[model samples]
Target: MIRINAIPLIASRTFLPRLPRTVRQYTSYNVAVAGLTESQEEFRNVVHDFAQKEIAPRAEEIDKTNHLPEDIFPKLGEMGLLGVTVPEKWGGLGLGYLEHTIAMEELSRASASIALSYGAHSNLMVNQLNRWGTDDQKSEYLPKLLSGEHIGSLAMSEPNAGSDVVSMRTKAELKGGKWILNGSKCWITNAPVSSTFLIYAKSDTSVAPSKGMTAFLVERGFKGFEVGEKLDKFGMRGSPTAELFFDNVEIPEENVLGQVGKGASVLMSGLDLERLVLSGGPLGIMQAALNLTLDYTHERKQFGKKIGTFQLIQGKLADVYTKLSASRSYVYAVARACDAGKVSRQDCAGAILYSSDRAVEVAMEAQQCLGGNGYINDYPAGRLLRDSRLYTVGAGTQEIRRMLIGRGFNELATAEDIRAYNDATINGGVRGLFYGIGLSLPTHYILNSRVTAYRNLPSPAKAFGFVMLIVPCMTITAEKSGEAFTRSQYEGVAKRELDKEAQIEHERWQSLSSVQKLGDWARRHKYGLVGASWVGSLGVAWALVNRNKHQTTSQKVVQARMWAQGLTVGLLMASALLTGFDSSKTEDPRTPHEDHTWRAILESDPHLNEEERKRLHEIKRAVVDRKEQLVKEASNSVSK
Candidate 1:
């Protein structure tokens, strides 16, 4: 008799309902990643303490007065934050983008305006100069900028060109030993306060906008260069943004930032870091919002109960918390990748885009949670909303950023490209580990090929691979498992966790409910599971037989057979209770319109005459009238 329960030990439902909304002190909430080095933790603590003690107190005054905190820069400089991304030889901290992002996040948590100005100075000007500036240029400007004696800003956006920065009107012409710059930059952060400005202008107007642009390092005192009126606006008030007028400004030949006609390269290269670093601003705002909401919910009462105790309030809190956690994870991961010099362009756009949008939503929700107080200026909720709104439009508009991300992914998504990426970057860590273990040559090659093949498979195939890999082991152990967990029960377990590590483990266990459900669904289809097992076993056996034909050495043949047997047994046991892939199933279209609207309706009934159209219109009208009537009734019922 066939061993029908070959993998009964593993088949159990993994997926389940989410935890219930509950209010409690998550005091052990440490948001830092578990693998943080000692130095990173120390640095984070230092920055957090600095933000809380030095920056937080001044945040209100800064917002109220709408004044740039010139005094704060010196303290930041003294702490070596100004040059965090710069090198030691260049009067910088010699740290990486990760550290820079940490500083940005901490500072922004206290005040986003301050953080915005800091980013414009540090990442936009100082870091770019460090990367592309000549030795003499660094020697002349690095020390003063790093020490906070000089402030710097970047100028690219112009009156008519914000998202289309390459089409800026600023024009620079090479003259005798200097360049004549004409035109003005609007909405320039740190413009009035900056001693140095890195401006982009068209060097060759005849060519394409991107190719014609050139970068120039213009000093504040340069002739014809003037700071214009400051723009008073909503939120980020203290950041001090203004127009920059360059009327025949004479820039020295040595001030040419990068190669003429290659300013686009300089500009595009710096944007990744700018986007990554600026993301911290939103992350900080989210954190502040979360803190404010938590405090407000716990203290404020309504309907004879603390609002925090209400499930609705708790649900809002949970959403904000989840968003903040996810944003933090993405931002930090991207920052680490930047530090590792392996940044993906799409991910850079994605991080800022995702975090920026979520930050605005979370801030608004925080404001809503506070009710009347959140609406008024007494709390920082209004300010947070205003500041967060700027992100959706700044750096790059959300629309443009979305296009960039989609375009980038489309360009890179190819079989060969995917395989190369896996070999060069994605699998580097694992490959190194295997190399360290001194695996046999054939084993190394085979494993790498397997991993590459797995990665290159289509999405559906990958899903199958995951199920085939996981479902068997779980199915075999299902007989030993206990009853399912309720949502409230899961939350209780999560809350009682003593530390971040324990909390993460509890979360992982809780998330298995959905997986368990999937496994159960698979178990319901017995024939499919058995067939998959046989197919997998036969495939493995056939592969081993073919390998034996090529193997001259007896040792190699033995090893191959052993590998085949192990894999076959593993597959058979796993697949005994796992579901098979159904080729007949069609993928759901990834579009918003389920029915394709009126076009689909018209296409389906193309033979209909004018009479049919008239009838359909009448039916639609009746439906609308019915909907309005129902809505009115619902409103009346609610009011009563």
Candidate 2:
């Protein structure tokens, strides 16, 4: 027997003991999980050891029997793994989300079904209670649930309302000092064996769907409350899922989980954390698949050599390993963010979305690596594949995650733009005030010359000039004065016209199908659009210039071609700008400081923080002082 250190050498940054070449060739070592403290590493090892010993052996049996081992819950409770995020005063380990995520990942590596059940109980039920439950409700339910003496579950989904939770028909009516729940919830995890449930119901239908919902604490023994038959799921067989039926189930006022009409807030508060922790399930499954594939590739032989020796097999191994490492790193990074109290909806959704999709691909690759042996139940690859598919549909569907991420980015960009606009307005006002004072004579001369020219024009030209120039100047003056005078009356009318045009454009864009949009893009850029357009215009001009019999000199023709080519290029550039083709998208528009006057650069960087802006101002002052000193030296040299 050989002994090897299980701690990851990379994580500890320590030297490893040298071993014989033969020993090193046959040994398989563990890669250190990153982003963990010493205590977190120890906790992970403890959970990993327990899971392999107690859960891995029974994983096959549990899958086949479609039932979890009877003592698994108690054993997990005894190890204090049941209430990972609960406070110590509430009979839990009182750890943060990172630790909880580690526990989920290790357990999932052993048995995904068991890990799913654990997450549902620990995160969905226990953590919610810890966060939102009243003191009395906590005293009554937290201890039993935390100890794993009684099972817990959360009910939010209905038969018709899985992704659209706000459409749930579960109504709760306040009647005679009690709330009566009168609807059903389906596809609930741990429903068959759970003793307590955190349920949401529509309390006030008059209000909006989000505002009308209320969360309640209901027990299994409540009158007219019953758990239906367990669902025969495609995967996660051992985690019992069933429908819950309620017919006039009475709940006391004290059992309300949060405020009467704030269930959405309570539900939303836990969703990001839930998504973060549950992401570990997919990470574990990916690890497990990689593990099975590595062992089989090493042992299995083909064509007088090990299959792992083949280039194709080695490539597959590399791909899977890279994916697993990348996914693990991303998940851990997001978990750390969550633990640091920087929970972002988009980040959480994005973490699970990316990991879950990759897990499926990794599982399929693992099965492919095993070749014929992968398809059979004898190998765990088939089970891993089935389990890996559940995540993209379970917490929230992949589609919902994408939409959430898009909306989050849209909101962030809009807020940033608004802030930039406000900053630009303040800076522009100050600069305009100083310019008006310093350049008053030049500004007045320019305006007076334009006015006199307009007055000298014909009646029709004068009317057109007034509409284009005079009205715009007047509007600008009125807008700068906060639109406080007579021009303010027409401001609303002009705004309405602008809004109408914008709405028409928006609707036109929305009406185009995705295929149409793609086709339009292709047409717009076909045949190197700008290049071809400019070249074609120049060719036409050249043809016309050569065909002219009146041109007696080659110099005039040469000048004509040059003017035509320059005009064509300028028009192409202008068209590109108007069509939103930004040629400098990769470059920061605010950069190349030497191109702008110092004041211009300082005015443009409104996105910089106050400290950064102050530093920039100091640099500008230093540059000005240095230039002034250089000028003085030059003057003294000339005088001498």
| Top candidate by TM-score | 2
Best by lDDT: 2
Q: How far is candidate 2 from the true structure (C-alpha RMSD, Å)?
A: 24.6
TM-score of 1: 0.61
lDDT, each prediction: 0.74, 0.76
Task: Report the lDDT tens digits of candidate 1 across residue range 210-313.
Answer: 89989999999988989998778799988999999988999988988889899999999999889999999999899888877876676565776778999999
Q: What TM-score against the true fold does each predicted structure earn?
A: 0.61, 0.65
TM-score of 2: 0.65
Q: List per-candidate RMSD values in Å.
A: 30.6, 24.6
Alpha carbon lDDT at 93, candidate 1: 86
Question: What RMSD value applies to candidate 1?
Answer: 30.6
Q: What stretches of model 2 exceed 4 Å from their correct place?
A: 1-33, 412-640
